[model samples]
Target: MTISERPVQSRQDYDGRSPFPGAHEHPAASRTQVGLTGAIVVLPFIALVIAILLAWGRGIAIADLLLAAALYVVTGFGVTVGFHRLLTHGSFTTRPWLRVVLGVAGSMTFQGNVIDWVATHRRHHAFTDRPGDPHSPYRYGTSLRGQLRGLAHAHLGWMFADEPTSTPRYAPDLLADPAMVRLARAFPALCAASLALPFLTGWAISGTLYGGLTGLLWAGLVRVALLQHVTWSVNSLCHVIGSRPYRTRRHDRSTNLWPLALLSFGESWHNGHHSDPTCARHGMGRGQIDPSAGLIRLFERLCWATDVRWPDPERLERRRVDVARKARAPAGD
Candidate 1:
């Protein structure tokens, strides 16, 4: 269905004109609550810097760096390929076992359980930059001070809010799936394992408590903080900055932020994604590096993924704003 024709809850239901029908009402966060939430978001990056300073003379171990890089890849792809592509958008299909594995890996990223994450993302897509969007940089207003507040809200402040997206409305498929339910329940344990695994790996490689601590510091806290910001950037900056190379449904301001391309594992190709939400490849044009797409291709080769939704040139051309503009121009020109 066209975007305009898609079903939407009444504006009053979503725009806070009325309380969400059956949803819990959360008061605005108090100063203490806001402070705590900000600390939770910021302290890790501070600790990471301190850890780097402490390791200055000794230098970070090659093993720790490698462990962090490896874990980053596994967990990052778990979000990009698994939580995002496979489950949320159905960009491709895979074996049930692989699906569970991907869910587990994504859960280890500590980005909430798959169901909640998917539900939140689906809601974001549903409203986009409109009044109901969960995290739009334009939420506050167009004034400078308002934009700054909106940026903060979009980047992280919204997480502290008591508002919750309805799982049944956004992710009923996952809610109905036994495997996904079990995986969601296992999220806490997976989070602990995500940290502990790096520590154990560091200890195993260097056989020292110091090595283990450093591993926990770098691979655990720092890695999580970095990935968290990269993901949040897509919600905040991708909507406010960067190039909107493709057309999307009205009010979707998603843009392609090339700087975040590698870090976000192709998710930074926001325009392409909003243009074709289910397409497996976001970086459809030349020199658009998309490691997530590469991983998906590898899975396809290994017979682990099937029916991949690689981009179609004709569809892409149809979606291009330039093409639409040319089509609208006078026939003589």
Candidate 2:
């Protein structure tokens, strides 16, 4: 008989698979260095200061006001309904054409592409207020100095740092779509058009070069700056200060600060969202008045969205009871 049999292999010879992707998965940050993050941050305050000075000196005009209002609503909703509640959290669904339109309009705001945005956001949710969280205000622990550092990190320092999430791992669904790829590639052009559109409209409406210039400054630059801060504030202020009326898990420090409710487009209802991440509505309580929710309802009515995950009273009741029990638990004395 054959004496040429090979030795049996050890069990340890086969390497176990890791849940994360390998080298081919993630592409590096696309040369869009966040060096401009600091510049963008500082420049906005300067723009605001300049705006105040101009307004005080009677340099403001009716067209400037109109353009500012228009851009604020457009880009603001684009981030809220498009980038945030829709794309990042999958709070709702939309039709094919609407999806492309939202992606394009959202790119005009010059936030990162949908894939990166969703990736970072998923990481944020995966480790909220924990060490690995992309932007956690609780990273430094609960001391005064630590909270200060954590707050700064949560606000804008995360962008200033180089801790980007891998899109292939966190946002494979988004990255696989060709429509999103086209929008991401065309992002710069869309942003340029966004800036120029207001100016063109102002020029056409007012029939003056000065109107176009002011529109670019006010509606274009200033608008971007303002929206950026509002979006970042959700990562910063919302974490630090808010009312946790709903029953999110104990470690999750999400709250609903009423003052920022409107500006954040129902996103300030943090506790509700943390409790049910996939539900289409964050502002689940009565009288919350979520404009984004209203828009989602419109999409559903128009057949642009199906399978909408609206809130359920029974689930909400069970959650509240669970929270109440935990709150009343006796200390281990």
Candidate 3:
């Protein structure tokens, strides 16, 4: 069925509110809470600075660079493929063990617990650039000054906001699962392990305290900070810049920024995703490199993932704004 022809559900359904539930209120963050949130965002940059200083004296080793790249890929995919496509959107189905592994790896990124991450993301989709969206560059007015403020807000300032998205209101499915609940509770431990493991690996490989520190700097802090900015760019620049080739729901102005495609693992195909959120493949067009989609395809081939929601060309054609405009135009014109 066409999008317009599909049965419309209530706002509650679209928001993923639980039918069976108590109040899922997210209270305003206190002064102390906001301070802590700011610290979390800032500490990584501090680490990056320290890493650079250390590199200035010792020089960056191949092992350090390799470790950082490897960990970045793992934790990055943990967010893109794991927290996003698999948990938030259900673009594909995987084995139970694989789900746990993905969830743990994602938690290691320190983005948030799985449940909270999914809840915030689902809420973002439900509201998009509209009033209830947790993060949107259009939240403020559209004036030049307002746009600049909103860009910063959407990019990283939103995380320091007093209020947060309620899990019960937006991720009841994840809350209902015992395994997910367990994983969410383990977020703290996973974060500690994420940093510690790299340190230990460096120490073991080089048998020196400096090696361990370098590993912690590169794989732990620098990697996390890099991923964090790349992800935030999607929220800010993806809406403000790039090409919008597909027709999305009203008020949704997601765009595809090719420069971020590789770093974000295809998530920069924001227009394609907002147009068809559940499609496993975001880079539908040619020459669009989507490593995440390629990884999903590999899993499918290996029988590790099933019922993958690969993009449909017919649906894409139907959603193309140019095509829709042509179809609606007078034949003589």
Question: Which candidate achieves the best lDDT against the true structure?
Answer: 1
What's the lDDT for all of these models? 0.82, 0.71, 0.82
Ranking by lDDT: 1, 3, 2
Models 1 onward score TM values of: 0.87, 0.85, 0.88
Model with the higher TM-score, candidate 1 or 3 = 3
Give candidate 3 misplaced runs (Cα > 4 Å).
1-28, 323-333
- Candidate 3 lDDT over residue span 1-333, tens digit each: 001111112243222222111112223566886786787688888988898898897788788889989999999999999999999999999999989888988898878899988988998898776657777776665668667877888898777765466777678888888999999989889989999988998998889999999999888888888898898998899988998889887667799999999999999999999999999988878999899999999999999999999988898999887956747955212
**Per TM-score, what order, best first?**
3, 1, 2
* Model 1, CA-based lDDT: 0.82
Better of 2 and 3 by lDDT: 3
Report the poorest 10 consecutive residues by lDDT, candidate 3.
Answer: 1-10
Where does candidate 1 have its weakest 10-residue lDDT segment? Answer: 1-10
Better of 1 and 3 by lDDT: 1
Clashing pairs in 1: none
lDDT of 1 by residue, 217-307 (tens): 8898788888888999999999879987788866567889999999999999999999999999999789999999999999999999999
